[model samples]
Target chain A: MLIDQIKTIINGENVSIALFFIGMYGLCARRNILKTIISMSILQASLVLYFLSLSFHPLNVPPIGADLNAYAYVADPVPQALMITAVVVGISVTAVSLTMFVSMFHKYGTTNWNKVKKKRGEIE
Target chain B: MRRRVLAVLMCIVCFVVIIASNKVPTSDDLPIATYITKNAFAETGASNAVTATYLFYRYYDTLFEALMLLFSIIAVIYMSIHEGDKYDE
Candidate 1:
């Protein structure tokens, strides 16, 4: 009974909502800037999941290859396509943020946001 | 104290909103799904609707995404150069 109930309740959008809250918690609670950046990536992933889940169907086929036998439907292509771009952008953003973090760490010798903020304040 | 409590409150608020909104889609897919599924083939000539959508419909965005990856990689390489000042490992 419990498993069936849980299965009914648990789906893509719901899971994404949960992940979004987890990412939000990470963003709000983490002291390390690196963790904060990772939280942002988590947030992006949750958004992607949310969009993909919007058109989710059990009997739906993939949006690939137009020619196919009788199928109920294909999932929305727009969300999948956009989410691909989102993933790419998210990777680049994470990469750029990491590089920036390394530079900051080297200069300041700390990765904690409070310490970095204090140090930056002292300097400028 | 305040931050932790606020975080918990935010979590509670988020859960409440989601439960209250009840906006999750459960029935048939939206109109865009049907339109794209049917017409994507005729319009793009690409078999894969997703490929057609990204590669044909919005190639510019894909190009920029590629550029962003390239620039970010270059920046990482350039910034991580050995500076002869040893710090923490």
Candidate 2:
């Protein structure tokens, strides 16, 4: 029953929203840019999951070919399409964020957000 | 103190709005997964809907995404090496 309830909760929009909040919390609370980037990646994963779930139809088969009558379930293509873009974009964003983090680390010799802020303040 | 109170109030308002909007629908309310079944062959020649979705419909987007990843890596490398030179000098 709990599993069913959990599934039900996940089926709706709550999963994505939860992911967003969790990611935001991680990004906001964590002083390390790497951790923040990881959190953001989790957020992106949640979006991917949400979109993929949206495309699911009960008893659907892999959508392909002329034999539509043979299968009871047909997979949703839209989410699949969207997710491809999402996955790619996610990787790109992660890469960019990570690169920025590395640059910041090199410039300041630290990964702590507070320390970086202080260093910048000193420079100013 | 005022700013902290204001932030808390904003947080409360956001929480209330989110909770109010969090309505879950039953299975019957869900959209019919017909698009993949109908357009699988035309859009993506593959039989697997997942594959078609990634390869055919969003191939260009995927490529650009990969490029973005590459660009980021290059940027990181460039920055690190550039900074290393400053220390060496």
Best by DockQ: 1
> Over the stretch B1-89, how does candidate 2's per-residue lDDT look in tens digits?
66545645554566457755766643652243466566666665666766765666567766777777787677656655663365543
Q: State the DockQ, from 0 to 1, for candidate 1.
A: 0.56
Best by lDDT: 1
Model 1 chain B scores worst on lDDT over the 10 consecutive residues at: B80-89
Off by over 4 Å in 2: A1-7, A10-12, A64-66, A122-124, B1-20, B24-36, B42-44, B50-60, B66-70, B83-89
The residue-by-residue lDDT of candidate 1 on A1-124, one tens digit each, is 9999889888888888889998998888779898899899999999999999887778888877766334676777888888999998888889888988988988999989888988889644
Candidate 1 residue pairs that clash: none
Looking at model 2 chain A, report the run of 10 residues with the lowest lDDT sum: A9-18
**Residue B25 lDDT in candidate 2:** 45
lDDT of 2 by residue, A6-100 (tens): 67655445666666666766765667878888988988997887777764666766566665647666666667776777887778677767777
Candidates' interface RMSDs, in order?
A: 2.3, 3.8
Mark the regions of model 1 whose C-alpha exceeds 4 Å error after superposition.
Answer: A122-124, B24-29, B74-89
